[model samples]
Target: MNQDIIKSQWKQLKGEVKQKWARLTDDDLTLIEGKRDVLEGKIQERYGLARDKAEAEVRDFEQRLRKH
Candidate 1:
């Protein structure tokens, strides 16, 4: 997803982000905030996903959040 869309609806996405990344601590979410790159990196590191797949998952989640 594009950064514009993510920026527009990040507040709503945050909850979904937390749910999907349940292993991430509150501090992790706090640190991620609106930075998709950071979020992608953390998800890759914590979940052992390849970089491209992790990014796509984050993009998918962000897009799903925007649809609501």
Candidate 2:
């Protein structure tokens, strides 16, 4: 999803994000606040994924959300 759409829908998606990345803390979600870059950073930090992999994961997650 686009940043604007992501931000607007964040509250709804937050729980699903947590479920998918259980290692992420609530504070991390707050910091992410629907910014794709921030989400990628957090995923990298928590999951130890490389930058490209983190971006791919976030992109995949966004695609899944769209499908649903």
Choose the strongest candidate by lDDT: 2
Q: Which stretches of candidate 2 lie above 4 Å from their native place? A: none
lDDT by residue (tens digit), candidate 2, 1-68 = 88999999999999999999999999999999999899999999999999999999999999999899
RMSD of 1: 1.9
RMSD of each: 1.9, 0.5
Compute each candidate's TM-score over C-alphas: 0.79, 0.97
Query: What lDDT would each prediction earn against the true structure?
Result: 0.82, 0.94
- TM-score for model 2? 0.97
Which stretches of model 1 miss by more than 4 angstroms?
1-12
Predicted candidate 2: what Cα RMSD to the true structure? 0.5
